[model samples]
Target: MKQRCVKPRFWVVLVGTLGLAVGCGKAPSPRFDSNLMVMDKYDISFEQQQDIANALAALFGTPDDPYVPKESGLDKDKIKLAAGPTKSDKAGVHTGLYREHCAHCHGISGNGMGPTAAFLKPYPRDYREGWFKFKSTERAEMPTNADLERILRHGIPGTSMPAFEVALVQPEIEALVEYVKYLSLRGMVEIELARQTSEELGEGERLPTTAEFLVEGVLKPQAEKWSSAETKLMPVAAPPADFGSPASIAAGKSLFYDVNKANCLKCHGTTALGDGVLNDYDQWNKDVAEFRTKADATLASLTEQRGKAEEDFATAVEALGADSALSEEERKQQRETLEKDKAATLKKLGEKERMLPTAMAYTLVPRYIEPRNLRMGVYRGGRRPLDVYYRIHSGINGTPMPAIANLVADSELPADLSEEEKAQRRQSLQTQRMWNIVDYVLSLPYEPGGELGADISMLGRERN
Candidate 1:
C-alpha cells in the first residue's frame, strides 16, 4: 500500500514565510479588493466595481483595520485580534493570527490564491464560496462554530492544513475562526452585489451601495444562515445493539454491492479501494471549469499568433539581408524598425495573456477529487463511528458523495398508510441503512487477509 504524504509543520511555516516575503517591501498596507473574477463573470463595469468596493469597505474595513457589523454576528474583538500585521504584545499575546499563520496559503482575502497556493495539490479553502466539506450540519447549511473550531484544533488528515491545537491557545483559535467568518460574510456579500448589478440592473444603472440596502437585502440573509447553522445540525441516532457484529458487517457488505442500495462499489471500487470513476471534480473545481476552459483556449490562440509573428519577423529580416540596393546605414535603420515592431507585437500579446487567469489567479486549475481509499483506513473527515455515520447521513458537502436517502420508497410501503406514516417509515429505514454502511466502512481495516489478499493476488496475476 502507498503511504499518504503529509507536509511537516516546520516546512509549511518555512515555505509560507518565503512565499510571503516575495510580496514584501510594498510601502502601503494591504487592503481587501473586490473579487475581479466574480465581477468579470457578471460583466460588471469599472464604475460599478468601484461602488461595490466602497460598499465592502464600509461594511468590512481594510485588512489593517477591520470593521465587523453588529448585524453580522461576528465578534469585533476577535476580528481585531486576528487582523493586521503579525505581532505580539510585550506579554506575548499574539495579534494578526490569520496573517501570520493562514494568509500564505488561504490569502489575506481568504480567496485561496496566496503565493504558495499553486504548489499545493488540493488548494486551500476559498472562504468566499461558503461551501465546506467536513461539517456536522446538512449539505445546504453553513458549518457550526464548533465544526470550524474542531478543524482548526485537529487539522485535516493528508492535507496542507495543520493542527493548531498545541501551537496556539484556545482563544487564538477562536479569534481565527471569527475572522474566517468575517471574510466569508464579506465575500458572500460581494458575490451577491455582483449578481444583482449584472443581472437585475439596467445596462447603465449602478448598484445601490447604501448600508440599508446592503444589510437588508444582501448581508442579512447570509448572516442569518451562519447564525442558524447549529440549529440545522443533522442529528445522529445511537447505533443498534448489534452495530459492529459480524451479522451487521455482512449486511453492510451486501448493501455495498447492491445496485439499488448504497452502491458504494460504483465509486469506491469492487475492493473498496478508490480506483473506480476518475473523472469527477468537486463543486469548487466544477464551478470554474468552464471559465478555465475558455481562458485556456484564448491562451492557446495567442500562443499560436505569437509563433506566427516570430516566423514572419524572421522572414522579413532575411528579405532585408538580401536587399543589396539599400545603403548599409539604411538597412541598419530598417532592421531596427522591424525589431521594434516585433517587440511591440510580442508585448501586446503578453499583456493579453497576463490578463487571463494564471496560476496566481482567483481560481486554480480544476482537479479531480479522489474518492477515499477505504483499504488505507484513512478518513479525511474523522474515524469515529459517529463521524462515519454523519458522513453517510448528510454526505460530505461539495463532493460527489450523496446523502443516504430513499431507502424505503413510497411504493414499497403499504398502500393504505397515511402520508406521515410513509414518511416515518422511510426515515427509519434510511437511518438503519446509514448505520449499516458505517459499520462496513469501519470494518474494512480489520477484514481478513484472505478477502483483501485474494483481490490483490488476482490483480497481480491479470497484470502479469
Candidate 2:
C-alpha cells in the first residue's frame, strides 16, 4: 500500500516568508512550487504547477481568502452565518451553511475525502469528476439545479448522508447547491490542466502553463454546460388515467424483463438485488479499455505498455526532491509492490479470451457502478412519486440506466405512419409505460420477499 502523507503547510508558510530560500541559505526553496510539494505524485514542472495552482485559487479561493459567488446565482453578501443553534429572522437565513453542514464529510475542497470519510461505507461522492448518479438529464450531462437541491433536501437512503430539509431553508439550500457546482467546476478545470500537462509531457511537447488559457479553454465550457443543465431537462409527461393500478403494475413487470424493451433484469438481476451480470463497467472504466478489441490480443499489448509506464512512474517518484519521512528502502519496496499488482491485473485480463457481448454489458466508462438493489427501497434519486417518474422518464445520467421514454419509439409502431403522428403516439406510449414501471418499482419493497408480479408466486409455501 502507498503511504499517506499529511502535507506540511507550516513549512510552506515559513519558507515562503523567508523569501524562497532554505537549507543553509544556499538551496532554492521548493515550498511554493506545487510540483515539488510532497503531496504531488505526478511531478509536473514548477511553472505549469504554479499556473494550475493559481487557476484553482482564482476560482475556488483558499481557506482564508474565500471566493463568494455574487453573479454565479447566490447572493454572497446576503448570506448570514449561523452561530450555534441561534435562530435568525426569515430574511437572515444562515450563510456558510455548506461549510457548517457538508465540509466535515465532503471536505472543504469538496473532494469527498473529508476527515470522517474513512469510516463510511460506499465513500462520500467525489464531485471532482463532475458526474452525478441521480439526475433528470441524459447520460454525460450535468444535472439540473433541481436535482442537486432535491438530493440535499431528501438525502440518500441507507447512507451516511443526511437530509437538510428541516435544518436549512430554501435560500440556504440554493446557496449550497451553487457552491457545490462551483467546487465541481473548479476541480474539473484542475483535472483538465493536469491531463493536458501529462499528454504534453508524454509527447515531449511544451506545456501550456497559462492560467488565462486554463480558464478560457477548460473552465468556461464546463461552466456553460452547468448553466445549461436545465435546458436538457426531460419533462415528465402526465401519467395515464389508470396510473398506479394493478394492470399497470403487471404490464410494467413484463416490460422490465423484455430483452429489447426495458430489459432492467439484465443488470438489476432476476431478484433486483444488483447481483446480475458481473461484467458491468462505468464511463471511466470503459475508457481504460477503449483500444481493446473483442478478442484478448490487446491484453499482451497493454501489458507491454504497462510495464514501461510502471518503470517511468517509479523513476519519477524516486527522482522527486520533496521532503518525505520514509527511508529510501521503504519507498522502493512500495514501488515494487505496485508493479507486482499491475502484473497480476494484466495476467487476469489475459485469462479472458473474448470480451462479453456489448448487448449484455452495462456500456459506460470509468468507475463501474453497481445496479441499485430495488428491493432495498433505497432510491438515491428522490423517492417522491414525481422524482421516480422523472428518473424513469429521463434515466440516471452517466450510468447504464436509460430513459424508458426514448425507448418507446422503437418498441412498437403507431397506427398512423406520418412522422408527426408517430411522435405523438410515441410520447403517449412512453408516458404510460414509464408510469407503470415506476408503480412496479415502488411496490417491490412492499411485496412478499421483495418479489414483484409473477415472481411473488415462486415463493415456497409452508408444507404442513
Candidate 3:
C-alpha cells in the first residue's frame, strides 16, 4: 500500500457551504476569514461555488431536506443532525448536546472557527484539516473511532476542550462522535470536489462523474481511514529484566544523549530546557531564526554601550591616581581589555535577555510550543512510566518527537532469518532500548541540572 503524506496546505482547504447564496431567503452565514479555503485560492467564483453546491445538493441534499448516506453503509440510527444529553423531565427528550457544549468553540460546521475562537490563545482546532494532534495510530494515519471517543471521554488536559464523560451518557458521546465524523467527511468532500472542479476548469473541461467520483475518491477513502486507524499501532514487547533498576536508567541516559542513537538532546537541549535547534525551529517556537536575529542585534547594541561604560570606568580610575591600586596607564590598558581577564559580564546579560519571554515571540500570532522540560514533572500524557513508553514507542503523532524505537535496527541477526524471527528479534531489541529511555526520562525531573549520570530509581512503575 502506498503511504499518503498529508501536506499542511491540504489542512487549510476551507469549506463555506452553509446553503447561503446572498439573499434574504435565509440569513447569510458569517464567513471564516482566518483560514484559507480552496475555493478562494483557486479563484472559484460565485457561479463555481453554486455549481459545486448544486452538485452536492443533488447528492447530499440541503439541511432542511437532508440526504443521509444510508445506502453508503452509514448507520441510519447513528446519523444525527444534533448531539447532546436528554433535556430531562421526559424520559426520552434528547437535546443538541454538541450545540450546547461544543459549538461555541468547535463551531456549528466543525470548521474550528467558532465565534469565541478569537479569544482563545492556541485557538480551537480546525477539524476541516483532519489533522488531530494526539492519536495512538502511527504518524500520518487518521485517528481511529476509539481514538476520537477517548479524546471526548478524557478531554485534552491543557486546552479548552472539556471531558464530556461526566456530563453526557455513553450513547450521547457515541452519537456525537458519529456527528463529528459526518461533519468532517462533509468538509473533506467539499474540499475534494472544489479541487476536482478547479482542475477541470484549468483544462477547460468538466468532471466526468461528480457523484461517483465523490463516492469513490472522498467518501470511501476517509471511511477506510476510520476503519484502519486501529491497525497502525506500533507493537511492543515485554520489558527486559530489572527494567527499572538504576543500571537501566544509566543505560537509558546514555541513549537519550547519544548523538548516534536517541539524539534527544537535539531538541530537548543539553540542560533539558527544550532549547535544541533543528532547521532553526524548536518545539516551542516556529521560525526561531527570526527571534535569534533580533537577539543578536540587541546584543550588538549593548556591546557598543558597554564600550562607552568601559571608557568611563577608565577615566574614573585615572582620576583616583595614587588612591587607586593601578597607575593611569595601567587603568587605561585594563579598560581596553575589560572582557579579557574576567568573564565578559556584558555577554552574560545578553544571554539572559534571550531567555526572557519578550524575546521569544517567533511569529505574528502568539503560537509558542517548547519541547517538554522533563524536569518540571508535568506531562500532559499520564505520569506513569508506561505513558512515557507509549510516547517513545509511538511518538507524539503530530509533533517533532518521533517514534524513537521504530528507527533502531539490530545488526547481528542471522542473514537468512525468517521474517517472523526477524520481527521478534527487532521487537525485543527495540523494547529493551525503549525501556531504557523511559527509565532515563522518568529520572529527568529529579536530576540536578537535568543531569542523568547519577544512579536513580525510575520515577513511576510501568503499568504493563
Candidate 4:
C-alpha cells in the first residue's frame, strides 16, 4: 500500500465542525465524519458512537488515506489514485479525484450533503444507503460495475450529475468507481455497527472490534453483494417480430392503462405528463421524512405561539393607555418596558425557528419523488429500447416503481405441459408482454394527444 500523506486542511474547511480526528501524532490525519444521522436514528449513545467511528477508521482509513480490505475486492491502487488531496505528483498522476469532483454535491462521506446539494431539484445520491436508482441488475441487487461506469460516462439526464466522459480518461473513471465502492462499503458497515451496538447489545456494551468478527459479521456480506451483481443481471431476450409495430404499441397502450397490468398511466398520467401521483417519497427521503415532519410540527407550533404573544402584547399596551391614575411620563415608561419585553420574546422565538431543520440544514433534504414526464422524452436512465426494457423489467430501485418481471407465475402455466416446457412458455409470454410496453413508451413522444382510440388508429395508419 502506498503511504503518501498530505495536510487535511481542505477537509477541515469543507466539513466544518463535523470533523472528528480518528488518529493522533505530531501531524494530524484526515478523518471521515461519522454518519451522525444514522447514529441518531438508532439512538446510539456517545460511547457507542465513538466505538463505531473507531472501528470504521480501523477497517477503512481516513479520506486522505483509505484502506480497502481484500474481502471488498476493490482495487487498492485505484483507490489510492482517487484518495487524498487534489494534486498531481511529479509524474502528473491525479489524486483526490473524488474530493475535487464529487464532494461538492455527494459530500466527503458520500452522504449527499455537499454545499450545493440543497439547490438542486432532485438531490445527488446518498451512496451510504447502498441503494441506487438506475442499474441493470435485479431490484434488490447491487448495480454491476458497468452500470456505475456508464453513469460516470453518460451522466443522468435532467440532473446535476454531469458526464465525466470528455474530461477524464477511462482509467480515471475506473479509479473513481473503486473509490465510490470504498465509501459505500464503509457507510454500510457503519450502519450495521450502529444497529448492532444500539439494539442487539445490552446498555453500555461495545461492538466487537476484532477483525474476524467485523469481517464475517459486518463487512463481507455487503462486499459479496457487489461482487455477485454480475450474476444477478436481469436477462433481456430479443424483441419479438412485431416489437415496434403499431399493433405492438396499441397492445402496450392497453397494458399501460390497465390497472391489473402495467398501469403506467396511474403514475405517468393519462397524457404521459407525470401528473398522476404527486405525494410519494423515494426511499432516501422516506427514511428522513419522520425527522422532517417533527421539525415541521415544531415550526408550526412556534408560529402559533408567536401569534398569541403578539395578541397578548397588544392587549397589555391598551390596558396601560387606559390606566386612570398614571401621568403621561409613567404611562410612556411602562409602555417602553412592555415593548422591550415583547421584543425579547420575539427574538427568542426567532432563534428557535432558525435552529429548526430546514431544506438547507439536512444532509439529504426530504423531497417528494416525481414520476417521469414521458411527454418531455427525457429518460434519466437512457432512452435505448434495452435501457427502457431493463427499467420496466426490474423497475427503478428505491422508488415507488415496481418490478413486473414476475408477470407469469408457475401456477399460471399450462398444467398438461412438462415442467421444462411450462417454464419455457412462461418466459416467452413475459418477454413479449414487456416488449409490447417498451414499444408504447418509445412511441409516446411523437404520438399526438387525442381520444385514445383515435390516437391509436392514427398512429397505426402512420406506421402502415
TM-score per model over all chains: 0.79, 0.65, 0.65, 0.78
Per-residue lDDT of model 1, residues 92-124, tens digit only: 878999999999999988988788898986788
Better of 1 and 4 by TM-score: 1
- Measured with C-alpha atoms, the lDDT of residue 377 in candidate 1 is 72
lDDT sort, best first: 4, 1, 2, 3
lDDT of candidate model 3 versus the reference: 0.60
Candidate 4, residues 353-434: lDDT per residue as tens digits? 6544422265565789988877556788988999999999988999998887355656778799997998899889889989
Error of 1 at 460 (Å): 9.9
Question: Best candidate per lDDT, number?
Answer: 4
Q: On TM-score, who's better, 1 or 2?
A: 1
**Residue runs of model 3 more than 4 Å from their true location after superposition:** 1-36, 40-45, 55-67, 71-76, 81-92, 200-202, 207-210, 277-368, 384-386, 405-424, 448-464
| Model 3 agreement with the true structure over 190-246: per-residue lDDT tens digits | 676677777755533554445567677656776666557678865656778878899
Clashes of each: 0, 12, 5, 0
Number of the predicted model whose TM-score against the real structure is largest: 1
Clash pairs, candidate 1, are: none
